[model samples]
Target: MKTLLTITLTSLLTFNIAFAQTPEERGLEIAIESDKRDTGFADQLAEMLMTLRNAAGKESIRKVRVKTLEVSGDGDKSISIFDQPRDVKGTALLSYTHSTKPDDQWLFLPALKRVKRIASRNKSGPFMGSEFSFEDITSFEVDKYTYKYLRDEEVEGKATFVIEQFPTYQASGYTRRIVWVDQEIYQPLKVEFFDRKNSLLKTLTFHDYQQYLDQYWRADRQEMVNHQSKKSTTLLFNNYQFKTGLTDRDFDQNSLKRAR
Candidate 1:
């Protein structure tokens, strides 16, 4: 009887501990697990076609090449170079993202023959007149936000975990972002951004995901809709290549300026 009582007591204690976890703790756990699943894949290269649509349905398109390098103990580094749309040709954006610190970003312009550093506070501004802000393009780091598990729901027939993440970056313009992460791939299917005023700012949806290397998933298209501006931007990604053997030199400011 004494041994049985001891075992029963220990089981009850463990159950209580599990049920007592706060929403914030659970949310962080989910984020950490999701980040863990996406930790591999040393590098990636892809092409993107960005189409911007105005309230009146006027549209414009730009072709771009993107490169990404995964970093250990920190966020990823990415570089984007404009290849088409003669006017924007030779333009390049480079970023080194971090978990707790503000991201370092620079824009190179062939016409000006200069490289301009992006201010941390200006991370909220639009990126080249697109619905995506400078912050939107930066790599998502788990430590960049404080999270709270909102609930579990289904998004487009896929089971998803919904969580609210409040940005920890000082210059962030968003009050919070609600994310719906798919249960299987841990990829975010939908995100709703709220501005500083806590008003709905934009909604981003990921579609047509394809798994690469039989392990990693890549979305073919991402659409960002601006609720207030009545405008939207669609980025169609193509030709995803992994393990491209890219190094730090490929993402330096020199590379950005030298991009053609």
Candidate 2:
């Protein structure tokens, strides 16, 4: 029997006839709606503890602070500063994400006392020896993917819309992603990543979501597990503050080097 969501998509396609929307269009509609629901945060800041576990189950931890500014008509700008792990201490990464064009990124290395520009081509590489690639950590923009509705399913007892999203640009380590989005919140509950060769690579799960400003939802914890490598990274977010009046100046390359 077709579920309600499936029936709805089918009806949308059926009604349009010649101008019928494909599963892709219906999927994109869901994505756009999800994106719309999360808008208007203005800005936010959070502190995180990242735990990286190797195949042997040994773990190393790093402390970091993150700042993000929502863009008016495009993707957000963000800066992540590493405060722990003495060797990488005081290091920061600045990123300006665009919905349709290649993202711009720069890394501040205190050891070198200079900022290094990260080429778009290298965005697929591992970040700080963790399972997450630089591409995996960017702010999500709807235009970044071409989506197709997969099915309606339940994840961890929560009703979800399963959709397949294909990367619409280059330098992405993942060729595609299957996402399980919570029906009520419009936020993703889980995501399975496929490598460049379309092989299953990693799965990310979100937990302990709390809403802020009575509208925005932020997860307290996120875990990403690498299937082939048997490695994992867990990020615990704390002290989330929203609408803090952050601006573009706070995310610039120069500010990255000056981040304390």
Please report the candidate that would top TM-score against the real structure.
1
26-88: candidate 1 lDDT, tens digit per residue? 899999988888778999999989999999999988788989999988989999898878888
TM-score (C-alpha) between model 2 and the true structure: 0.90
User: Whose lDDT is greatest here?
Assistant: 1
| Steric overlap count per candidate | 0, 0
Count backbone clashes in candidate 2: 0
Tell me the lDDT of candidate 2: 0.88
Worst 10 residues of 1 by lDDT: 119-128
Give all TM-scores, in the order shown: 0.93, 0.90
Give the deviation of candidate 1 from the true structure as CA RMSD.
1.8
Let me know the TM-score candidate 1 reaches against the reference structure. 0.93
Q: Show where candidate 1 strays beyond 4 Å.
A: 1-10
Q: Candidate 1, after superposition: displacement of residue 5 in Å?
A: 6.0
